[model samples]
Target: MSSAMDIPKGRASYKKKDGILTLTDDRTFLIWSPMPANGPPTVSLALDKILNLKQTPDTSPKVILKIIEKPKNPDEQEGQSFMFQFTSPTDARTEANALRDLLSQLLAEIRGGDPNVPKPLGAAGGPSAAGGPPPNAKPPSNRWYDDDSLKADTQLQQSLLDKDLELAKTHAQALALKSDSISDESFNKQFWSSRVGLLRAHAFEQHQKKGSYNVLSTVKPRAENGEFKLSLSPEQIQSILHQHPLVRRIYNENVPKLSEPEFWSRFFLSKLAKQLRGERITDVDNSDPLFDRYLGADNSLGVASKITAAQHVPHIIDLEGNEENQGGFKSGNRKDAEMRPRANIPIIKTLNSLSEKIMADVAPADLEPSGTPESGAKSFDDARVFNQLSLQDLHGEREAGSIRLNVKDQTKFFSNHGDGISGEDAQIYAQQNPEDVLFEVVADLDTFDDDGAGGIDLRKSIGVDDDSESDHYEDATMSGIQKTPHVGSRAARRAAEQQILEGLRKARAEHAGGPTGANAVEASPMGIPPDLTERCYLTQMTTTEFLKQFWSAFLSSSSSGDSSEGGSAAAAAAAAAGELAYHVESLKRCVERIEAIAAEAERDRLRAAEARKKQIQEHYQKTGKKLKWVPPKGGRDSVMALFEHTTAAIEKAVALYRGSRG
Candidate 1:
C-alpha cells in the first residue's frame, strides 16, 4: 500500500540494486537495494528534497521527480541536485493522474496550507481554478523597452515639428497687421532669413535621414521594371506654400493664366525658383526664434497668446487675382511688378524676446534617450534577480568537476609509452616533425610481422590489409620504410630493429647500382628500357598499338623467372623494384596531365561566369529590370570530371602493377 511506481533502468543508476521504490505517510521516500531480513533502506529522502514533479503519459509512461538536494554536511560544496524517474504499469494515464493528485495533497499538507507550491504535473490537460497566474509570481519588467515604439515616437515627434512650422507662417502674417510699431519691410527681411531658411534646411535634413539621396528625383528605384513618379498630397502642397511665401506669391499672380498643377510644376522646375527653393544653412542658432515663439506647443508660452493666435490668425495664403485686380498690378514696370512684401522689425524683436523668456522658464528637450537597464542603474547589483529556476548553479558546479565518476581506486588498464620521454624533448621532436607520431605508430604497426614459419605471410598483426599498389611509391616517399611490430621482449625488439636496419642498408646499396635486369635490355635515347620502347614511342605507334605493347610487356615481366645464381633472390627483388620505379614515373606524368586539364577548365569556367554576370548588370542598366540570377557551372564540376578520368587511370595503373607483381 505504501509503494510508489517502478524506476526504469535508464532513468536511475540503481547500479546492481533492485529499482523498487517506496513512499510512506511519514513523507519519507526510500530506494531499497534489496530487502534483507533486518536492515535499513539503501537510500532515503524526505519530502522536502523534492522541488517539483513532471509526468509524461503516452505509449511509454514516465514520472520525473525534480529534487532540490540539501547539503549532507555543512562542509559540502554548493549545487547538489537530483531528478528521479519512475515508470507506471498498464493504464498509464489513469495511474499517472491518480499519483499526481496524491502527491499534490501530500505537498499541500507539508506546506501547511501555503498555496505557492507548484501544482502536480498532469494538471496541464485538466481545467484549472478560475484564476490567472499566482499572486506570488513576479510580473515581467519593462527595463528592456520596445525599440519599435521608440522609433515610432521619434517619427511622430518629427512630423509634429513639421506641422508647427506650417502654422507659424500664418501667425507671422497675422501679427504683421495687428502690431502698429512694426513695419512690413523689417518683419519680412528677418522672417525670410530665419523662418523660411530653417524650413528648407529641415527638408534637406529629412532627405539625409533616409540614408541616401537620388539625384534624378525623391522617388527610389524599385526592383520591378516600371516607370514611377512622385507627387505631393493637398495637405503637403498647402504646408509647402505656407513655408515659402514667395512661391505662393508668384503662383497667385499667375493663377488666372495657368492651372494650379502647371503653375507649381513650372515654378519648381525654373532655374531662378530652384535657387530660392533651399539654402545650405547649417547654423539655425543665428536665425530669429520667430518660428518657435509664434507656433510652439510648449507649456511655458502664454496660454492667452496661444488662444488669441488660434482665434484671430488669418492663414497667409496668396490671393488669386481676377482680370480687374490683375490689371492694377500687371500694368506696372518690371521693377515695380517684382517688388515683394517686407517683414516688420519691431514685431520680430518682440517675438524673439518673448520666445527667449518662454524657453528659459521651460525644461529643455531631452537630447538623449533612456539608457539600458545595466547602464541606467546606480549599481549593477541593483538590477533584479531574474533566474527563478534555482538550477543554473548546478550546471556551473558540474562543469567545474563536481559529481565526477570515482575511478581513483581502479587499476591502470593501459601503459603510457611516451612517459619515458621528457615533456620538453617530446615537444621539440613533435615541432620538428610535421607528421603526427600517432599516425607514424599506426603505419608502423600496419606492416607484416614475422610468422613462426620460414615463409613471409605478409599479414598485419593489427589485422589491416596491405596498402594498395597505387599508394606504394607515395607511401614509401612520405612515411619511409614501415617497421614490423616487435612482439615478445626488449631483446626481441632490438633484434628486429637491427635486422631491419641491415636490410635497408643492403637495399640502398643495390638501388644505387643499376637494377639487376638492366644489362639484359638496351636503353632508348629518351632513357626508356627496350622492353617499353613500343609503348614509349608516341610517333611510331597509335594508342591501340601502345596498349597492346604495354599488355605484352606486363605479361612478360610477370612470367619471367629468377636466375639460378647464389644472388638470385636479390636479383629478382631488384628487377621487381625496377618495374615499380617505371610504374611510379608513369603515375607522376598522368597526375601532371590531369592537373593541367583541371586548371584550364577552372579558368574557363570563371571567365564564363564573369561574362554572364556582366551581361546581367548591363541589361539591368539599359532596361532598369532586375533579372533572376542563373549561375554558371562551378569549378567543382570541372574538377570532378577530371577527377573521374584521373581515378580510372590510377585504377588501371594499380592493376598493371599488381599484374606485373603477380
Candidate 2:
C-alpha cells in the first residue's frame, strides 16, 4: 500500500485528438508496484508529464477513436485508459521496459495459488488488450481460430491457421520447458526405456557373438539320423539352426515382425504326425530280440558291440543240372543256360540341328519388290541400314515420314553457353525476341538542295570531271562575281544587283548581241542589290519544288519546238531518263562510306561491350555473384540498333553549312 500510494494523484486524462497528456486535472496514480529481492521497493509515479508526445497524431499509439460525450454520472467518470495501446515511438525505451518489469513482478506474486493475490486488470474492468491473457491462449481447435471480427484468422489468413504454424511454436515452447524440468517420474520412464534398449542391444550382441543363433522361443526341428536316434539340447539345436543357410535366411526374413516366443515355436521345434515327439529314430524299440544272436549277459554293452549283426540274413539258393557250366564261385551245383542272340537294327535319326549343313544345301530366291525404292545401297551386305536422325525430332515420336534424307550424319551446334542448339531452335528461340535487333539501313544522297524551283544537280555533288566544252549551251547567259570583300565596300552586293538590271536593259536595247546573250556584273542601272542571296544563305531551292517548276517550263518550251521533241529531246525528259547518270553513282559511293562509318561505330560499340563484359566477368570471378546464369544457346539478331542521335546532329550541321552559300 505504501508503494502504491507513492504514485502521483491525477485525473489521468488523455487528449481526445492525439492522446497527449494535457495534465487537465493531475489525478494520475499507480495501482501496484514491484518489490525486488534484497532491494528497496520501486516507487511508481503516474505523472501527467506528456514527456514524449508525437508532433503528429499518426505517431501516437493507436487507441479507440473517442466520439462519445462525457458520462452523466459525475462521480463515476473514467475514460477508457490506453493501457492496451503501445506507447508513442518517441517514448523512452527505459520507461517502457520499467513498466513491463513492474507488471511481471505483480504477475509473479499473484500467480502459483497465492491466496493474497489482487484481481487481474481485466477482471476488475471489462478487459485490457495488453493486460489480459492473449485471446488466442485458450482457443478451441476449430472455431476459436475462425473468428471474423478478430484479425487472427479471416479467410485471408485461414491458410496460416490450417498450417498450425503458431500451434507448432507453442508446442515447441512447451517441449523446451518440459525438457528443462526435472522429476522422478521422468527419470523412471527414462530408466525403463534405457533398460529395454539395453536388453535388445544385448540380445543382438549375443546373436552376433555366436555367429548365428535363434533368440525366438521356437521348437527343435526333427531330422533323420540313419536308423538310430540322435538329438541335441535346445541351445545346440539353436546353434545348428542359426548356422543352417536356409533356416538363418528364414529367420532374417521374418525376425523384424516376429515376437520372441512365436518365432521359435513355429520354425524350430515343429512336430510331425505319426511320430514320437523330438525323436530322431524310426527303428523298432525291441533291440534286444533284433540283436539276440550277439547279446551277452550284459545286454547293453553286447548290443552296442554287435551293431553290424543287424545285416545278417537266413536264406540261400542252389542250382543243379546235368553237364552244368561251373563258375569259379561254385563247382558242386551248376546249370547251363541256353544262349539267344539279340537283334540290332539301324536307326533313322531325326536331324536336331542343320546349321552349316542346311545353308550349304539351300539358298533363298528373290521375293517381290516392296515398291519402296531401294537407294544408297551399293552391295548386298551394306550394313548401314538404319537412317540417322536428330534426337529432338524423335524424342516422343515413333517414326518420321519416310522421305530420303540428304545427310546421314549427326551434327552438334553450340553457343557462348554450354547448352547445344542442335536439331531444333526451340530451346534457343525462347531466350530472345526478334524486335530487339537492328533492321533498317541508313539512307544516303549525293547532294541536298533547298529551292522551290528544280535546280541543276551540283557538279561538285556528283564529283564532276573537267570538260570545258561550252558549245552545249547556245546564247546561254552566265554570271560570275568575286565575293572576297568588295574593295569599294559601299554595299557591293547592291551594285551587283544594279549591274544585273543594267545588263538586262542594255541587252534589250541591242547594246549586247541579243537578249539571248544576257549577262551582268557588279552593277545595275538602278543599283537595287539582291538582298536575299547575301542576307540569307541558300545552297539551292528546295529540290522537290524546283523539280516541278523546271520540268513544267522545260516541257512547255520543248513542246513549242516539236511535239516528239518534248518527250524525247526535252531537258526534263533527259534528266528523268538519266537519273542513274546524274546522282546514282555518287549516292552509291556515299552509301558505302556511310555504311563503313556505321560498321566502325558498331565495332566501337562491340569493343566497349566486350570491355564491360570483362569487367563483369572479373567481378563475378572475385565475388562469385551467385546468380551467374548460363545464357541459353541462341538469340534472334546478334546486333541491336542504337540510334546514337549523333547522325541526326551531323545531318543538321551539313544542312547548316550548305545554307550559308548563296
Candidate 3:
C-alpha cells in the first residue's frame, strides 16, 4: 500500500487497471499499478470532490465512486463527472458503504451540519416513490393567535401611525403652515418637517440600550427642603465602591444597623464624604458622628506600603536602594515634596486608590500579574539587561569631515556683484561717513537729562508734566528739611512746604462735616444696587445648574442608538424621551426666572431713584446749596448684562429642542 499520490491529469479514464488503493494523510485516494520504474501512483482523487459512492450487486462486487472533475475554464457550462470501480467480492460492498458514509459526513460538514452523524443517501427534499413527505420532515406549526391578540397588534401599529400624525401636526404648526387641506404636497411637507424629530426620537431610543460609564462628579446631592437628597444608580453605586474601598467597607459594616437611605444621607454630610470629594475640611464643616469615625480609616502610609509591596523594582534600576552610592556619599533617605505623605491623608489615599483602579482597568490582559516572582524574572531578563547595559565601541568610529566647497572661481564666489548692487557700490555704502551715525546717536541721546552725578533724571526722560514735576520737587523739598542734599536752596524748599500745609488746612476745613478721603464710601460700579447684584448672581447659578442637568440628559440620549428589536428597546426609548423632556422643561423654567429677576430689579431701581431725587430736592430747597448727588449706577441694564449670556444659552437650547421637534 503506497502512501504517496500522483497529481492526476484532467479527467483520467481507467480501463480495469490493476492497482493497490490507498488513502493519504491529506485525504487523497490513490490507485496505481506497481511499475518497474517505481513512479508515483497514476490515479488520485480528493475526498471532497467525490459526489456519490455505491456498490454493484454482482458476484464480484465493484465499488463505483462518482466524482466531479475540475473545469479548465471558469466560463464552462458544467463540470464533467468520472466513475471509478474497485472490485473485491468479499469486501467491496463493506468498503463502498464505509466510503459512502464518509462522503455523506463531509457533505454535512460543508453545509454546516453535524459531521458526527452521516446524512441519508439520495437527494435532499426529493419526493419518495409513494409521493409522501420527505424524510426527516419537521412537524407543522402549533402556534395560533386569537382575535384579541391580533386586534392588540393592529391597535399598536395604528397607535404608532397616530403618533406620527400628531408629530406631523405639531411640526406643521411650528413651521406656520397656513393650509388645512391634506393634499399630497402638504402631507409630504409636514412629513419632512417632522422627520427631524422622528430621527432624534429614534436616536434617543437607541442610546438608552447602550452601557455608559458612570461620571462621579454628576452624582451630586441636592438640598430638598431642610434635608439633603441623593439619587444613585446601581452602576454608580458599584463605581463608588470600586473607587473607594473604605466607603465599601463602611457600608458593609453599617448597612445592617442603619437603613440605606439614612446611611446615604449621613454619608453625604460626613467629613469622610468631603475628603472623598476633594473638598477642604474645616472645623465648622458639617459632620456625622457615626460616619466621621471612619474618616481616618484610609491611611496614606498604609496605601503607600501596599503600593510598594505590589511593585518589583529590579536591582539594576532600584533608585531607593542605591541612593547611598549615587553621589559617593552616605545619603540619608529622602523624598520629593510630591512623593512625601500629604497633610490630607485621606485625600492622598483616595488619589492612590483611584490611580490603581484606573491602571488596573486599562492595563493589557497579556501582562503578567504584578509582584510575582515569575513576572519579575520575565520582566527583567538577564540577556535583555545585558544587551541594554552593553556599550557601543567609539574608538573605531570615524568622524565626518566638514563639507568641502568646490567653487570653480573663488573670486566670483567672494564677490557681491549679484542682484541689486555691485561690489563697488556696496563698498562705497559701507565706507560712508561715521560722523553722520555719531550725529544721529547724539540726537537720540539728547532726549535724556544728564544729572551731573552719572545718572539720567528719569522724570525728565519720561516727559513728566509741569504740575507733576512741581509736586515731585515739593516732596523732595519737604524731605530736604531732614538735611537731604538733593534739593537746591533751603529758602525755596521752606516756602513750598508752607504752601502745601496751607492747602491741606483749607481742604480739611471744607470737608469737616462729612466723611472724606479714605473714609468716604465708594459708589458701586455701573450704579447697580447690591441687592439686584446678589439676585443676578443667584439666577446665574440656578441657570448654570439647570444647563448642566439638561446637557447630561441630552448627551446621554444623543449617543449611539440601539439597533435591537424587542419590548426592552421600546421601553428604553420611552424612558429616554421622558428624561430629555424633563430636562428641557427645567431649562425653560430657568430662562423664565432670569426674565422675572431682571424685571423685578428694574422696578426696584425706579422706586429707589424717585425716592433719592425727592430727598435731594428737599435738601437743596432748605439749604439753598445744590448738593452733589451720584445716582445709583446700574439698574435694569446692569441686571440684564449679568444674565445676558445665560439667557442666550437657554434660548439657544430651547430653539434647538423646538427645531428638532419641528
Candidate 4:
C-alpha cells in the first residue's frame, strides 16, 4: 500500500475530454482534448512564443503552464497560462524551472539572441526566464539525497551513460553497413572483427542450442546411438502417437493389431527378446572336445571373476542384515536354516571324505613353505586378501561421497550422528527400488570424430542417401521460401521470355560477324588465328542465299576461260568451293554429335529433376498435404530454343553446300 506522499513524480491521469498530451520533436508541445463531430481541440503554444515564466509551489505537486506571449493564432490569448495536471505527483517548482529554461533557449534562437543570457522579469517580478537562481542563492536545508549518496548516484549514472554511448556506436556501425553507407570490406575489417560480431555469434550459438531450425546440424538424432534421443514414458509415447506428426506416421504404418502400450513396449525394447535368444553358431566343432571345453570354461570364469573383492564381499555376507546380526534369526517367511545344522550331517560327511581324498593325493614336501621373511622385516598387506568392508565402510568409498575428516583436528566434538544406511545397504535398496535412480547426463568433451580416429571417413555416420530428405527439411524450414516480385506471375513470365529472346538476338548478331568457311583462316578479334581456335564456325546465311553466291563466282571464272590466267582462276574457284563444301560437311557432323551429347545431357537432367519431384510427391502423399511450388518454365524453354537454333543453322549450312555442288 503506497501513501499519497509515496506517489512517483511526473505521473498524471487525463480526463475523458482530454484526448492526449503529446510532446513531439516537430518543434511543438500541445495538450489535446476531444471534440464531438469535429477535430480535436488543441491547446498548443509554439516554442518560440514562450517569453516569461513563473513557479507556484503553493499548489503542492500539481503545476500550471504559464506563458507571457501567445502564438499568432486567433483563438489563443496573450499572457495567459493554462492548468495541466500530470498523471503522477511532481515537483511544481522543478517542472516550472525546466520549462522556463527550454522556452528561454527556444525564444533566444528565434529572436537571434544569446540563449544563455537571463531574461528580464515580468510585471509580477517572478523568476527570470533563464530558470537559474538569483545571485548569492542559498541551498535548501532539506534535500532528497545526502552528499555521499548523490556522488554515488552520479557515478552510477556516468557509468550507464558510458555504456549507452558504446552501444550507440556499435549500433551506428551496424546500421551504416545495413544502409550501405560503409563498404563491406571496411565494416568487416573494423567493426566485424570487434566485440559486436563476437556477441552476435555467441547469441546465434545459444539460439541454435535451444532448438532452432538448424536442427539437422545440431540435433543429430539417432534412436539407437545418435547424439540425441527422446526419452518418453508410455503416456508420453501415447500422446505423441496421437498428436506428434512423425510419431503418428510411424504408428499408422505399422502395428495395426497391437494396442498402444504393447506397440510402444515393443518399440522401446524390441531387441530384448532377440538378445535373450542368442545367435546360433553355424559351425559346430566336434573335433578337439577338450579344447572346446577349455574355451567355454575360460569364458565363464572371465565373466564370473569381474566382481571385485569389495563387490564380492557383499554377496558372501548379508552386510545389510549384519547390522546387529539380524540375519542370525529367521526373517519374513523363512525359518532359521543355520539353527538346524544337525540336519546336514550327511553333507558334512561327504565334505570330510572329499577333503581326505585331496590330502592323500598331495606330496607333503611340495606343500611346505618355500621361503619366509626375516623376523624383523615388515610384510605388505595385500588388499585383495585383507579387505573386510563393513556396511559403514562401503558407504563412503566412492569419490566425493565421503565426509573427509581433517587430520590436523585432534579434538573430537560430536552429537548423535550415525552413518545412516551404509553403502552396502544403500546398494541393496537401490537394486530393489531401481525406478528412483537417476543418471547424470554428461557431455563427451572429445570433439575429434570417433570414426576418423579409427582411419574411417566420419561422413559415413551421416548417410547422405538416407538423410538427404531430413537435411532438405531442415534447410527449407530454416531458410524458407520467400515470395519475390519476379516469380510465377504472368507478367514475370512475359518479362523473362522477353529477356531470353533479347539475349538470343544479341548472340545471333555476334555470330553473324564471326569468321566462317574461308574467312575462318583469318585472325580473330583477339589476334588469334581461326586455325588455332578450339571450334569451327558454321555459316550464318540461309541455304538458298549461300548457293546463289557460290555459283555466281564459279560462272564468272568459267566465262574468262579464253584468257591464259582463266585456267588458274577456274582452278582457285573450284578449290575454294570444294574446300568450303568439305568444311560444311565436317561442321554438319560436328553439329550432329554436339546435339546428340546435349540431348543426352538434357535427358539426364530431366530424369534427375523428375526423381526429385517424385520424392517430394511421395513425401507429400505420406504427410497427406499439398504445397505450392514455382519453377522457371520460361528459362528452361529459352535454353531449349538456343539448342534448336544452333542445330537449324548447321543444317542450313549443310543444305547450302549440297545446292552449290549441283
Candidate 5:
C-alpha cells in the first residue's frame, strides 16, 4: 500500500485486465455485485453463528465490514478508524503511518480467504445465500414500508440488538463530550481577559496536536425556564463564544497571518505549555517538524513525533474505570521518573506566572475544598491505538460529508477539566460550529473517446442480474462516481475549468443572498494545490467532505492562536459554545413541545371539520331540514393556543440566548 488512504474516493473505477477497482492506496475492493439475495452485509460468523449464517463459507476473503443499514436502501456503506494523540507534528505523522501499516496488514489478512470452497459449520437454522430458507427459517421480505411511527420504530428497532444499543450509547457519550468542555465554571471576566495570550498559544497547540477533539458537556441553566442564567461572567461568556464554529472560523480566518513566531510568542509562558504538553517538532520522519509536533494521536495522518512519552508512562485503567491496576501506557504526565511532578510543589508557580509581568498572584487556598477535584491522566486513559478511531468513532456521524455533529448535550464530559470558561458561551459555540461536516472528492484523471461506439453492457466478471431493471443491484454502493478525463485533453480541461468557475459563481451568489455559517467555504487566492487537485469526490462524499473541512478549519484555528497555550482565546470560547448549545437544545425542546400541540390542534381541526360537514350533509339529506350559513368555530382557540405555545417557548429560549450574548 502506498500512502494508505483512510477514505478513498467512495467510488470505483476498473481496468479491463484486472476487472477490479484499484485505489491509490492499493485497497482493491471487490463488489460481489448483485448482492446475493441473502447477503445484506454486517454479519459475524462464529462457531455459534453456524445456525445463523446460512451462507456456506466462501472461498473469497471474508471482508470484515460494518454495513450501516440506513433508513434508505440507497445509502452507502461506511468504515471506522481508531485514533491516537501525539505531542508533536512528527508524532502525528508517525501515528498515522502506524495506523496505515496496521490497516494494510489487516486488509491483507482479510484478502487471504479461500475463494471457491464453502466451509460448513455444523449448526443449521438460517436463510441460504441463494434466497432460500435454511432447514426451518422464515422467508426474507422483499419490501420495506412505514405506515405508523410505533409500528416502524418497533420493527426497525428489532434489528438493533442490545450490542448495537451499547455501541450507540458509547457514541452518544462521545458526542456529549465533543459539545462542551465542562459544565460548571465561575470563569469570571478578570481571569478570562488575563488568559487571552496563553489561550491563543494553547489553541495553536490543540489544533497542531489534535486536529479536533470531539468533546461535550452539559450545563444546567440557573433558571427553570430560561436557556441561560442572567449572571454569567465575561470569562464564561467568552468561552462559549469561542466554541461557536462561526467564531472559531473568524479566529482562524486568513491563517497565513500567524506564520510569524514573534507575534504568536508574545506571551512569556507560551513556550512553557509547548514543553509540558509536547515533544520537539524535529525528528519526525514524514511531516514538517514544527507544525507536525504536538499531535493528539488520531489527527496526525502518519506524521512522526520525536516524543516517546508513551514508551515510559505506565497506567492501568480497567475495562471499566477502577483503581485496581492502571492501564498500559507510560510517558510525560505519568513521568518515567525523569520529569518533575508538580503534585508536591504546588501550582502557585503556574498561577503567578500566568500573566506577562509574572507579578504577585494569590495562591488558591488549601483550607476548605474548592470541591473541584481533579483526576489524574490515568483516570480516563485507554490504549493509544484504540483511540485511533476517526473522530466519528470518538464522536458521531460515521462518515465524511455528513453534517457537522451538533452539540445537543454539552454537560456530559468536558466540564471544568482545564481552564474555566463560562457554560453559556460553551453552548453557543457548539451551536454555531457543527461537528458533522461534509466534503466532495476530485480525482486527477485523463479522459479519452470511447474506443468503441456500442458499449452499453461491457459487463465485468462481477454478477449482473439480467432479470433486474437496475444494472447495478445496489444503488447505494461506491459505484456512483463516474469517471472523468485527465488534464491532457483540451475539451476535458475546458469542461473542468467551466465547472470550477460555475461552482465559484454559485457560491458567491449564495453568500450574497444570505448569511453562511462562519466556516462556510470562501474564495481564496491560494486555492487547492494544483498538483494534487481532486478529479471528483467519492459517492459517499458528504461525510468525508465534512471531515476534511472540519480538519482544515481546525488546523487554521491552531495556526491562528498565539504561542501561549494557557490563555482565554479559543479555550474560553470553546467552553462558552458548550453553554450556548445547552440553551439551543432547551429551545429545541420547547419548539418540539409546541409542535406537538400544533399537531394535536390540526387533528382536532380536521375532526371538527369532518363533523360539521357530516351535519351539513345530514341536513341536506333530510326532507325539510335546510341550512343557510355555517359559522366557523373552534379554529380561533386552537390557532391561538398554537401561537401562544410557540411564542412562549421562543420567548424563554430567546431570553436565554440573549443572556449568553452578553
Candidate 6:
C-alpha cells in the first residue's frame, strides 16, 4: 500500500487507514485512500486554504476540516468551502488534537500573525481544556474567510487605499498632458531638438576611428601565389575618394573604359599612387599610361597652396610663412643630407588637401571663429599663444616667488659631517690624497746616483745586497725551521714605512688648515640682499607687463592696415607709438636696475674679500700657522652677465621700432 501511495522517501505518514495521510514540506495536506471500483482515490489540499478545523469527542474521534477551494473562473466568488472528515478511534483523538494545533500554527504563520492566538474554530472545537463545539451550534459566518477586518487593522487598509488613489491620480495627470495626436512636424522638431547628444556621441565615435589607419598607406597590392591582388573595403574606397579628389576624378573618367578591377590594378602601379602615398617617384618607377596624364592635375588646381593659405596658425609656428620671409632659401636648396626632399610638389599638395578635408570633417561645427573682423582678423595672434610660444607666464606678476633658502652657518654647508669633520673621515681623506707620497717617491728617485753598469745600483743605495739577504734568510730558516719568508732588510722596510707615515701626517696637516678646515676664515655672504632681490623681481614683472601691452598694440596697429587709409588707422598708429615709447622706457629702467644690482653685488664681493683677508691674518697670528688661501677668481658677477643680453634685446627692439616708424 505504501508503494502504491507513492509516498516520498523521508516524509512520515501521520495516519494510515484504507490509505495514508501526509503533510509535505511545502505545507500541502495529502491524502491517499483506496478508491471505489469506478472513482479515483487521492485528495490534496494546501494548509493555507483551510478555513476551519474541528475534532469530534466520540470514541472514534472524527476530525472534520472545512477548506476553501480554488474557483474555476477568476471572476467567480473565492473561498468556496469543502468539508473533509477523517475517522479512526482510540489513538486518533490525540493525533487529531496534535494535528489541529499544528495546522493552526502553520495557518497563522502563512496568514501573518502570532501562532499562539486562538484558532478560528469555536471554544468547544479547540484542543484546550475547553471542549469541541456543540453539534447544533451554527458556523460563525459564511464570509469569515473573505473578511479582511479579521486579519488587519482598518487604519492600515485606509492608508494603503489612499496611497493607491494618489498614484492613480498622478498617472492620470501625466496622461492628460500627453497629446493625443503626433504630427510629422512635431515629431521632427522633437527629434532634432534632442539630437545634440546623439551627434556628440557619433562625432566621438568617428574621431576614435580616424587615426586607426591611413587610407592611402594601407592600400597596397599583395603578391599571392603566381599572382598580384589588391582588395579594398567599401569604407576604404570611400575614404580614398574623399581624401584624393584628383584620383576620384580620374577614376570617374576612366572606370567606364576599364573595369573596376583593371582600373584599380593600373592605379596601384601608377606614379600618381606613389606620390599620393608620399613616396619618392623617379622616372624608373612603373607608370600607367592612362593615369600618368593626371599627375599634373592637382598642381593645376593649386589645392595645396589654397589649403596652406586657409590655415589660421600663429606667425611663430608658421614655417611656410617664415620660409617665404627668408626669400624661400630653404625651399630652393637641397643641402640637408639626412632628410632629402622626397615629396614633390604634387605630393605636398595632395597631403595638404587631405589634411584640410580630414580636419573639416572632424572639427566641431559650433566652434567660434579664431579671427574676427573687428580684431583686425589677426587669427591666432592672441596673448595666450604668444605667452605659450615664448614660455612666459600669462599672469607672472600674480604668482608668488619661491622662498629663499637662508643657511646661517656657512661652515656646515660644505662639511662632510653634519656638524664637523670626523677623525676617521679625516684619516681616510689623508690616505686618499696621494700628492705628498708621489712627491716623496719622486725626490728619492732623483737622489739615486748612476752605477758603473747601465742601470743604477738600487740595492747599494738602499744598503741591502741580494746575496747576503738571501743567505741570512736561508740560515735563519735552517736554524729555526721557520716558514716565514724574507721580504727585505729591516732598516730599509722601516725607512719606507717611516716615509709613508710622514707623508700621511703632512697630508692631514694640510687638510686641517685648508679652506674647508674648522678654523678657516668664512667668505663674505654671496647672495643678493632681500630688498634688492624684491626690487629686481618688481622691475622684471613691470617690464613683462609692458612687453605684453606693447606687442598687443603693435600687432593691432600692423594688422589694422596702412595709417594713410583712415582716421581710425592714424589713431591706432598714434596709440601704438605711445605703447612703443612706454615699452622702451620700461626696458631702459629694467636694464638700469640690472646694472645697479650688479654694481652693488661687485662692491659686496670686494668688501667680503678684504674682510676675509684681514680674518686670515688674524687667524695666522692666533694659531701661529699660515692657512692655505685661494683668492676668488675674477669674472663678471652672475648678476651682470644678464645685463648684456638685456641691453642687446632693448637695442634690437628700439631699432625695430624706428624702422617701423620710418
- Compared with the true structure, all predictions reach lDDT values of 0.43, 0.32, 0.54, 0.39, 0.33, 0.53
User: Which of 2 and 3 is the better model by TM-score?
Assistant: 3
Candidate 3: C-alpha RMSD to true structure equals 29.3
In the range 1-662, model 4's lDDT, one tens digit per residue, is 21222212222223423333333233343333333212222344545445555545655655554445553477655555555554323454554445445555556555433222454545125444677554323334322223333233333333333556644444343333232333444333333222333343333443352211211112122476643353444434432332223334445455346654554444433321111112222344133321222222111111111112112223234343463455332354556666745534433433443333333322222111111122111122123223443355556555666687768654454322334667898678767743434322122213323664565444442323333333443444468755444233344445789999998865653343234543542333122223322222222122222333334434544454445365686786765565465445445544554454445444544665676678779979999776454331212232234346656655675676576567
* Residue-wise C-alpha lDDT for candidate 3, range 1-662, written one tens digit per residue: 21242322121224554444444433434343222213234444545344444444546534565656445367864456656565554665565555555555555443332222355565255866678766445334321223223223333333444666644343333223222333434333323332334444443443353322323556778988986779876557655655566776777577658976787777877788777776668999786788788776752321222223333444565555575466422234544546565567655546655665544433221222333233445354434545557676734677888898887878877565555787899798789789998998889787789887987886666554545335544566677755434333445556789999987764443233123343322223234455555555555655665566566656666562355357777777776677567657767766676677668767877887888888889999999878777665455665566566788898888787676567
The worst-scoring run of ten residues by lDDT in candidate 6 lies at: 32-41
Instruction: Provide the TM-score for each candidate, comma-separated.
Output: 0.17, 0.12, 0.27, 0.17, 0.15, 0.26
Estimate the lDDT of model 1.
Answer: 0.43
Indicate which candidate wins on lDDT: 3
Stretches of candidate 4 exceeding 4 Å from the true structure: 1-21, 34-41, 57-62, 71-80, 85-87, 90-104, 113-662
Model 3, residue 426: distance off in Å is 59
Q: Per-residue lDDT of 1-662 in model 6, one digit per residue for the tens?
A: 32233323111122242333445444445333232211122344555445555545555434554456545476867556644454444454444555555666667665432222444555435344556555234345422233332223333333333555543343233233323353333322332232334333333443364342358888899899978889877567756765676876776577548876787888888898887787778989996789788776662231223223233455666666887877684546546676655546656666665665665434232212333222344644454456656744554566677898888888865765543767898778767758887899989987876687766777666556656534555576669876555445654466789999997864453333233435331221124444544444455544444444445556666777564466777777776676566556656666676677777766765776787788889999999878777654212354443344555766777677777879
Task: Give residue 193's lDDT in candidate 1 (0 to 100).
Answer: 29
lDDT of 2 by residue, 253-301 (tens): 5554774345544433332110112133234523322122221211111
Report the Cα lDDT for residue 604, model 1.
59
Ranking by lDDT: 3, 6, 1, 4, 5, 2
Model 4 lDDT-worst window of ten:
297-306
Clashing pairs in model 3? 206-561, 206-562, 526-633, 526-634, 527-633, 527-634, 528-634
- Residues 86-122, model 5: lDDT tens digits: 2222333343334334445545443223121243553
Ranking by TM-score: 3, 6, 4, 1, 5, 2
